[model samples]
Target: MDFSLLKEAMESNSFEKIADICDQLMLQVSAQGIKFEEDWPYTIHLLGHLYVNDVNSARFLWKTIPSVVKEKQPEVVAVWKIGQQLWMRNYSGVHEAIRGFDWSPQTQGLITAFSELYTNKMFHLLLSAYSTITVGDTALFLGMSEENATNYALQRGWTIDSVSGMLTVKKQPIVTEQKLDPSKLQRLTEYVFHLEH
Candidate 1:
């Protein structure tokens, strides 16, 4: 199977679309009766899924990979470690897995993007979930060093209780406004009237 499409996508840093591209290519590989372990970059394909925050897909991909490939390709195993951490919601382990591996150029971009996405997501979640969190816990959740995480929180307008080593979260107020579409409501009313008859 020619991997030009996959290689081109990676070279262009199209991380958002790589997961879909990998799925398409896998379908072609299956139709052509090509061996998945032959020359395919399973590592990148797996990481692409994670980049899109599709941990379920990434887990399924890990299960489908051949044992030989899993054992021989340490990088593939390392990527799966990140997936496992994500699956278990072990935020600190996710950071450890990411930092422990030396990803190749083909996968580094995707990994970096995933890291940023995960960090931003956790940051928002923590904001809503906590009024105050310890700097150490924040570091684990944000995948940064304690000092860096403290600075990051501070820069985001969060205050720190120096005596307690706790960083206070600055949550933005949520404003929700619901506006119903008249045409849709009219159609629903008509449908109800028709059903009544």
Candidate 2:
């Protein structure tokens, strides 16, 4: 497999394309009858799927991985721990799995990006889904230390009750960015008028 594209994508931190690039590379390697066990970067391929939040794809990839590889490659097994945690919606487990592994340089960037994305996603979900949440739960969801999570919430304007250690989530107003252009609106209005007539 010519890994130039994959290397370039990683170097540039183009995480969104990693999954597709790895998928194409997997196909090419399979077509050439290349042995995956000897030199394949299975760690990167699996991490790419997780980076893109494609848990189902990650699960499928895990299932297709050869049993020997699964048994022999500790890194691949570690990556699947994150996938399994994600599949089960165990937020704390996901954080623990990510932090517990010392990932190689080749896969570290994707893992970091995945962690940040997961944190941001959980932050937004909390903002929308709950009015109040405990400090420990917030820390687990945000994948940070309790103090750091409390600080993060404070920075985002959420109030923390000191005694209860529960955060009062301050939901940000949703700002719609799609302003109606007058000409387009006029054109749409005219079209509707014609349709009605």
Alpha-carbon TM-score of each model against the true structure: 0.85, 0.88
Best by lDDT: 2
Give lDDT tens digits, candidate 2, residues 140-180: 89989999999999999999999999999998988889887
The C-alpha stretches of model 1 lying farther than 4 A from their native spots are 175-197
lDDT agreement with native, every candidate? 0.89, 0.91
lDDT of 1 by residue, 141-195 (tens): 9989999999989999999999999999998979899999999999999999999
lDDT for model 1 comes to 0.89
**Candidate 1 lDDT trough over 10 residues, lowest sum:** 34-43
The C-alpha stretches of model 2 lying farther than 4 A from their native spots are 177-197
- At residue 115, give the lDDT of candidate 2: 91
Candidate 2 residue pairs in clash (backbone atoms < 3 Å): none
Q: lDDT, candidate 1, residue 182?
A: 100
User: Which pairs of residues collide in candidate 1?
Assistant: none
